[model samples]
Target: MRYGIVGTGMMGGEHIRNIRLLDDVSITAIADPVESSLDWAAQSLGDQQPARFRSAEELAEKGEVDAVIVASPNFTHRAVLEPLFDRGLAILCEKPLATTIADADWIVERAARNPAPFWTGMEYRYMPPVARFIADVHGGRIGALKMLSMREHRFPFLVKVGDWNRFSRNSGGTMVEKCCHFFDLMRLIVGAEAERVYCSGGIDVNHLDERYDGETPDILDNSYTVVDFANGVRAMLDLCMFADGAEHQEEIAAVGDAARLDVLVPPGDLVFSPRVGFGAPKQVVREHVAVDDMAMEAGSHHGATFYQHAAFARAVRGEGPVEVTAEDGRRAVLIGAAAEISAREKRAVEMRELDTTG
Candidate 1:
């Protein structure tokens, strides 16, 4: 597979590194407005430098690549994807799909109508731990599903990726820009559509003028959301990038009637607690059963990126379902957008109100 990448920023660079590791796929072209970014990518990939284009249009018209990976800013996703769709090229787009519901809907509609495969960069779905957790839940290791709680905490944005992400108009706030990953995870764990969402957030940190230029930072720096799923499952997400000294922390805990499963981190430690009952005033019996010892392996964020790219490549070859479909991406955006609306309005917002049909 010959792959072309748009936007050579952090995510784009990660994609380049991962694609280089794959056996059959080659990054044939790269598109970025910044000359420095293109030069850096070309230099990093040894002698087999990818063709560089100044814009998505130029790349789509001249690159003649088999697949295009859109890792540009949030607002540029639709613009990059439209040309790729017209050219009948498979695509692997970064999360959040687009900054707005209408734009996201357009991409979803295109994917439904087009023959070329479209995959979203919700790479967490490929993590071995997460995958195993999903399987266990589906296998009924945990009784009836109850709730999901996840927290993604980290330091403030440090990497300089243009000025688009600092403002909500460009990135659709931090919730939509960053929390889409958590929202997507919640959806996967709940296995149900989000019925309602209530949120609260504020830009209490990272209030630097350089970050937002003269424009006010409308994007929240800290956010909390409660999502109600249609299957009587509730999910709570806490996303805060302003936490001091915290590199990153991610955990997903699922509560069930008989057993509880918790994925501690990227390595995804699964702890199962079977329900135990004791007689009140009579007698107590203890059962000695050895706990399952599944060795957890640390995961490379870059490896997850490579895994996602490989899945996209395989899907293009008509192998299997996309790791993360276009509809999945749209749902993530819808959840995040609804959370933002809820935060702004100080009330719970129905997810259906933000759905495509609405």
Candidate 2:
């Protein structure tokens, strides 16, 4: 399948690399507002040269590709979606479908109206360890999951090409921008929608002194949120941006009435064995699955990003189903957006109260 890549930033570059590894999938075109970015792509893409465009509109007008991979910033998803609407193009858009519920609904409406092959980049579900966790949870390895938690202890946010990520309006608040992966997986694993959220965090030490000439520093560097699910299962997120180069970048696990599961993704290997107990604490036992050498990270999802693209490619080729449907992406945004609201208003925000639905 021929692909047109929008936004030649870090994500765009990573997608290009993973796509090059696949058979019958090739990068035919690339689009970005910055000319320097296209130059970077030209040098980075080695032997394969793709047609360059200044915008998604230009690429869409050309109509030369079979699919479009949108790796642009969060707020620009709607702009990218506009020109491609009704074109019956297969699209794999990045997460937080849009910065706002209204915009997310707009994308959903068009998908419902025209019915094309479309999906979002909630790539965590495709991770071998994460998928295993979900399977183990539902397969009764961890009988009746009660609570889930995820922690991301990493360095400060990476600098974007345009610095648009510094402001809330442009990046849809940092949680929606960064933590939506965990949020989406939380929902999928627990098998329920988030009923409410309570978040406490601010631009505390990491980027507190940062400022542009005109823009305010609104993105938070740390956030702690407790999301209550409709099924009475609870999930929590502990995000700290100042602890870069710490022991591990991410740690996630779930606890059930009968047993528990944990995952840790370091740089070189995904060393995480599921320890489940059928009875008391003394009966805890470890599963003997061999560890996978994940020795790579594409935009911080670790080895899962490549798997995400593979799934998208399969779906685009009519060989598989679209797993990260539009609603899945929207619900994740809804939960993240609510977390933002909870932080701002200093109160628990009900998911249903927001102008969003999944």
Candidate 3:
């Protein structure tokens, strides 16, 4: 399948590398406003260099591509996607499909009615350990899930895309920008739909002089959220973007009837243990099973990206299941939107009542 890439940023570059690894896929075209980014990709790919364009609309209009990967800025998603949707081309869009619920709903509704496939770039679902853990949980190894906890703490925004990510209007704040992964993962593990959400956060640190359309930054850098699912499951999400020393930390813990499971992303460890209770005059039983070294090699941080692309390619070729679907993407965005509303209103936001069916 021929693939076209829009937005030559960090995630876009990762997609390029991943596309290179697939035998059936070729990146036919790339579009970015930045000349240097387009030039850099052309130089790196050599004979496989893609046709570079100045805008996503140009690529969608003129490029001979079967699929388009939208890795552009958060706010530009709808603009880029609307044109492609008209072409009836398959799309792999980055997470938080859009900055607002209305835009997300539009994309979801359009894709559902369109003939071509629409996939979201929620790559965390394709992670090796996460995939395995989900399988085990579904297979009843962990029994009925009860609670979930996820944390993501990374260093300050020193990277190039860091500036754009600091604003809520641009990046959808910390909850949508960063914690969407956790929210989606929580949904995947619990096998439930979030019924309500409550969040508390603010721009406590990382006070960079970043502005969106000349407005002061409104995105939160630190956040904590509680999500209640319809299946009687609960999830807590903790996110911080200004950790001084920590390089990166991501983990998800789920408590079940038979065992407790913890998935640590950095180390790629899925530790399982039987539930044990200690009493004043009783011995403690130790039952822990650790599945370590489950992630791809250290340099291959784009494993899930590669896997997701391959899955989409196969699906286009009339193959097996696609990793993440448009409906899944819509739910992720809905959860994030609910969290944002909860944070703003200082109250729990109900999920199902929201007009997301569009």
Candidate 2 runs further than 4 Å off? 267-300, 356-358
Superposed by TM-score, candidate 3 places the C-alpha of residue 231 at a distance from the truth, in angstroms, of: 1.1
Per-residue lDDT of model 1, residues 94-203, tens digit only: 98799899999999999887778888889777665666677788788779889788887767765556767777888977878889988998888788889999999877
Q: How do the residues 1-358 of candidate 3 rate in per-residue lDDT, one tens digit apiece?
A: 8989998877787888777777867889999988888887787678987788999889988898999999998888999998899889888899878877788778878988768888888888877667777787888877888888888787664454446765778877667776777788888888888998999987777755756577666777788999999899999998887865564477677788877877766666777777656543433233322332322321145257666666888877778666677777778878888888888889899886675463
Clashes of each: 0, 1, 0
**Per-candidate TM vs. native?**
0.90, 0.92, 0.90
As a TM-score, model 3 comes out at: 0.90
**Which regions of candidate 3 deviate over 4 angstroms?**
158-162, 208-215, 279-302, 356-358
The per-residue C-alpha lDDT of model 3 at residue 282 equals: 38
Task: Report, for every candidate in turn, its global Cα lDDT versus the true structure.
Answer: 0.80, 0.81, 0.78
